[model samples]
Target: MVLSYEPSVKSRIMVCITPQKSSRRLVERGAQRAKETNGEFCVVYVNKNSDISQDLKENEVLLELFDMAQKLGGRVSILVGKKISKTLAEFARENNITEIIVGKSLRSALDVILHGDVVNPLKKEAMKNNIRVEVIE
Candidate 1:
């Protein structure tokens, strides 16, 4: 009899970030998870407006976050889309992502009602694809 061993698949972790300083924490968490699992780490941001310069502060923060992600040995992606949740889900599927990390919603109830929730839809898509979604505070 012969015994064979097969290596497990590497985790592909995606961290979804907004243009806020708190997003750095999510990036750090993703990086840590990737390191622990010997996996790929990626940071993603979805922008609705074509002109990022419209919000100077937000743009600056996003740039800083992107730089931090790079420093942590992670790939950064800035996608333009009307729907953030759909865009994120599509990107995850295309990249063969195994896990997704997201921060707790900071939007107000009115804002959520007006714009729709990103996590729920994203979770639905992830569930259908057998992907893991983690919400961090």
Candidate 2:
């Protein structure tokens, strides 16, 4: 008996988006990397319930991200959660994401004091899952 099997291919790349200017850069870079690697591109945006003001700003950015992802032949997700970094990591693991592209935080002092920085924990979590994380400053 001869069996021909197909190799397993799970090459999905995800980008973490926020309302900062760097998000645009991150999406562009993530798309380029995905294209170069012949991988699927995805975008993840974490939404926090505490900030009503943030919601409006983030919505605008989210729309741009969606458009960007669509143009790149990819998908985008907006997750509502308290822990931004943790949520993104979980999404990556669940979606079989190989790489995560995130932009440096533009969080205000009050926001940082309230919620903490996202990039550090995100990197740690990604490392634990063996997911490559790229931080764009």
Using TM-score as the measure, the top candidate is: 1
Error of 2 at 114 (Å): 4.7
Cα error of candidate 2 at position 89, Å:
0.8
RMSD to truth, every model: 6.9, 6.5
Residues 61-130, candidate 1: write the lDDT tens digits: 8889989999998888877899999999999887778899999898999999998999999999999999
Q: Which pairs clash (backbone N, Cα, C closer than 3 Å) in model 2?
A: none
State in Å the error of residue 100, model 1.
Answer: 0.4
lDDT of candidate model 2 versus the reference: 0.77
Off by over 4 Å in 2: 1-8, 50-58, 108-114
TM-score of structure candidate 1: 0.88
